[model samples]
Target: MLKFIALRLLQGMLVLLGIYAVTFVLVAATPGSPFSSERAIAPEILAQIEAFYGYDKPLGERFITSLGNVLQGEFGPSAVYANRTVTQIIAESFPVSIKLGSISLLLALVLGVPAGILAAVKRNTWLDYLPMSVSMAGICLPTFVMGPLLALVFGLILKMLPVAGWYGPEYVVLPATTLGLYYAAYFARLTRGGMLEMLNQDWVRTARAKGVPEHTIIWKHCLKGGLIPAITFLGPALAGIISGSFVVETIFQIPGLGQWFVRAALNRDDFLVLGLTVLFAAMIVIMNLLVDIVQVALNPRLKYD
Candidate 1:
């Protein structure tokens, strides 16, 4: 187990390094300087700006410094928006993304698991049909569309939830729930399929023959095994959502990193965009690592030794 974990960590480091190199090269090679979009300043001021940030250094020196900082966990500074270090940007904005992603994941699991179980148990009955239909709706619609619709119904018409702003609890409901609904459909279908497959296996029949309490057999014996494949999706799904759902955040007027990313991209804030990409890629790597560990932990019989 220790060896397995160490290997995974090493692999994660290699992947992150590759991602950093690719992002750096891509951003550097893209047309112009980070300061290209800024209004004209005197050559002296420009030179000063470049020198202060080490942009005055040769490309190789800059690359080495950037890579060194990355090794030290420094993501660099935003040249345009916020005028803050990458760490500062993450410190300020990451909590919002984390909160949204966490809540949405929780929401997916809470609603998805039960609905899937019921659908599997009920099979083709009306009880099964309703949730499947709802899942269809969820899959068909997107966060951006649902976010505004939810805001309208829950915010405008009802005046119960706030339509915009991230002041408090009310602000999060529409956006998080909207984002969550999309994934809920995915998880629900996964669970339903996995459960159904498990139910058909000879072990399920044996459990029935032995007259194990139906609930116990279903929940205890069936569920754990059934959920393994579903667990595999969690890492990438969470990372993708956290990376910034620009449309959802935009429509909801939420001050998340996603919103920041979009505006930064539009303004050609290369440094800001690059910083966001690195942050997101790191998140993806970490989430995948966590999922791998969790998946192994959940199934002790699976051998890493």
Candidate 2:
């Protein structure tokens, strides 16, 4: 187990390095200075500014320096934001993203699991048909579309929830719901399929022959193995959520990492963009590792190595 974990961590480091290198190359190749603005600075002043940030160095040297700083967990300064480091900005904003993502994930699990269980158990009945249809619709609708329609119904016409801003608990409902519902649809479908497969297994037939109560057979015997597909999706879903959903954050005016992530790209804040990319890449690696570990634990037939 320790060796497996160690191997995965090593692989994760390599993946992060590759992601960092690729992002750096892309950012460097892109035209326009991070300092570009409406007003032009004097040549000498611009030279001094570039030299101050070590941008005056050759590309290879700059890349080496940036990589060293990244290894030490520093992301340098933000070019667009006058007095902030990339690290500082992430520190302030990542928690907001985490909060939103956590709630959204919780909501997905709460709503999706039951819906899936019902759909599977009910089979061809309306109970099965209704939720499957809704799940299909949810899958088809992108968050950009769902966010506004929800805002219109619940925020504008109903006036029950705020359309934008990251203020109180009330502010989170629409964004979280918008994000959660999409994944919930996926979870419902995955769970239903897994459960259906589990239900048809030989053990299930054996349990039924022994006259075990139907509900107990479904809940106790089937549920654990049946949830494997949902669990598989959970890792990437959690990582993506925690990294922040750019569209949802934008629509809802949330001051999360996603906001900075988008701005960093457009404004050519190189360090900030690199910092967020590395952070996101690292999260993906870690989450996938965790999912594998969890999957192994759940399935006794599976070996860690």
Candidate 3:
């Protein structure tokens, strides 16, 4: 297990390096300087400012310097934000993103797991069909569309929940639902498939033959094996939720890392972009590693390797 973890960490480091290299290359290749704005500066002044930020260096030199800084956990100054470093911005905003993402993840699990179990148990019945149909619709609708549609109904028409801002729990409902529903659809499908497979196994038949209660058979005998697919999907689903929050954040006016991320991309704030990318990629790698470890632990048949 230690060897497996060490190997995975090494691979994760390599992935982070590759991501940094690719993002740096793309940022360098983009046409505009981060300093470009509606207001023009004198050429000499611009040159001095560029030199101050080491932007005057060759692309290769800048990349090397940036990578070295990143290795030391220094993300450098933000080009667009004037007085802030990338690290400062992330520290301030990431909690908001995490809060939103965690709630969305929890909501997805709550809505999806029971529905999936029911669908699997009640196959060919309305109890199966209704939830599955709704989940299918959820899958079809992307967050960008879903966010506003939800806002329109719950916020505008019904006038129950607040449409925008990140002030309180009331503000959380729309965005979290919009982000969660998509992943819930996937979870529901995965859970149903896995449960169906488990229900058809020989042990399940044997349990039924032994006069075990249906609920007991499902909740105890089948649940662990049945949830394997959903567990496997959890890591990627979480990563997707974080990335997808960028759009949802915009639609809902949330003051989160997603807001900074989107602005960094649009403004070509090189340091900010690279920092956020590294942060996101690291999160994904760690989540996947944890998921793999959990999956192996849960199933005795699965070796760590």
Which pairs of residues collide in candidate 2?
none
lDDT of 1 by residue, 154-273 (tens): 988999888878889878888888888888888888888888888888998898898898788889788887787678888888986776466777887877788878877776666677
lDDT (Cα, 0-100) at 226 in candidate 2: 94
Q: List model 3 lDDT by residue over 174-234, tens digit each.
A: 9999988888888898899999998989999899999999999999988898898998989
Top lDDT model: 2
Clash count, predicted structure 2: 0
Indicate the residue-level lDDT of 220 in model 1. 79
- Pick out the ten consecutive residues of candidate 2 with the lowest summed lDDT: 238-247
Clashes of 3: 0
Q: Rate the local accuracy (lDDT) of all candidates.
A: 0.80, 0.93, 0.92
The order of the candidates by TM-score, greatest first, is: 2, 3, 1
RMSD of 2: 1.3
Query: Candidate 2's error at 168, in angstroms?
Result: 1.0
Whole-model alpha-carbon lDDT for candidate 2: 0.93
